[model samples]
Target: MKTPVIHLDVDRLIQRIALFALAGLLTIGLSVLGFHHWQMSDPYVRAVLEIEGDVSHGRAIFQMNCAGCHGDSGDGLVGPSLHSISAHKTRASLIRQVIGGQTPPMPQFQPSPETMADLLEYLETL
Candidate 1:
């Protein structure tokens, strides 16, 4: 008995290659969206600074969200005083700190980006 030799089907091989190429393209597209890198240049990205929450609303947010740590006058408590925070940190940097949190003592506040920006702007007025 002779062992059978398998022959490559050229048409099938071509279809397989095409399918793999399409799959690769689709995977890359989905990855871009999942990671949001596709919109990084959108300017609306966090880089645009959408601090759309109203200052007055932010004042309330501060009293409720921040006063516990920052106090009515932006004075320090368990957290450092923010009275002159604007003088100390850039608006963007301040916004990042609030959202990202800091060392072990500071837990991250899960405020919407809008609320965080509003909080930062209101802090500036302090």
Candidate 2:
């Protein structure tokens, strides 16, 4: 008895692979362009886009207000570590939490939207 041999078309396989690669590249390029357009068009995102966050100012604010409890590097002294807070919480939630002053044993501080935005940006850096 003789075994059957299968012959594969290498050219066809290469063409299919190239087609898939091109499609993937096109999809990613369009997605990036669309996101750029959305950022420029959306009012809320645009506002943040126009105004660059001041890391230095945010550091000052953090040092003055948050360092005592959160520690200098936000490593958690009395309060929880803020270095990874952004990983667990959204910017809006963090801002609201800070403004609402719901954290027990921590003093409540009233900060303007701009200040809170700066603080949130700073916290994200941590």
Candidate 3:
């Protein structure tokens, strides 16, 4: 009786590993680039970031638009408390959240770039 033999190609195995590593690195690099581009592509984001904000004006805007849900002081009513919100969310993230309204019961808010900047400034104080 003859025993069966198996062969392994060491060079081929090394090539495969290297190819996979290269592919993984390319994927990560592309993802990072794409994210950065996506953030910069929004005109509102760019405009808001460029302008300085007015906290008083922002407070007024909040009182008019958000007080019903978020409370006059942003202490949370129907909506969640905004205290320390800046600590948890980045400015850009806050912008997206306000505009996206992905969460149920929270309507999408499309403020102008200057108004958004003002709101962001006020949120930081909460």
* Clashing residue pairs for model 1: none
Model 3, residue 65: what's the lDDT?
88
User: What TM-score against the true fold does each predicted structure earn?
Assistant: 0.57, 0.58, 0.72
TM-score of candidate 2 versus the correct structure, residues matched by position:
0.58
Worst 10 contiguous positions by lDDT, candidate 2 = 42-51
The 10 consecutive residues of candidate 3 with the worst lDDT sum are: 32-41
lDDT of 2 by residue, 49-116 (tens): 34556778888899999999999999999998887888887554565567667878777876655666
| Candidate 3 off by > 4 Å | 1-36
Which is superior by TM-score, 1 or 2? 2
Pairwise lDDT winner, candidates 1 and 3: 3
User: What residue runs in model 1 are displaced by over 4 Å at the alpha carbon?
Assistant: 1-48
lDDT (0-100) at residue 77 of candidate 1?
Answer: 84
Q: Backbone clash tally for model 3?
A: 0
lDDT of 1 by residue, 43-85 (tens): 4336426545577878988898778876787887887788788
In model 2, how large is the Cα lDDT of residue 91? 55
lDDT of 3 by residue, 1-126 (tens): 989888899999999999999999999999988887898789888889899999999999899888899999999999999999999987888888888898868899999999999998999999
Best-matching candidate per TM-score: 3
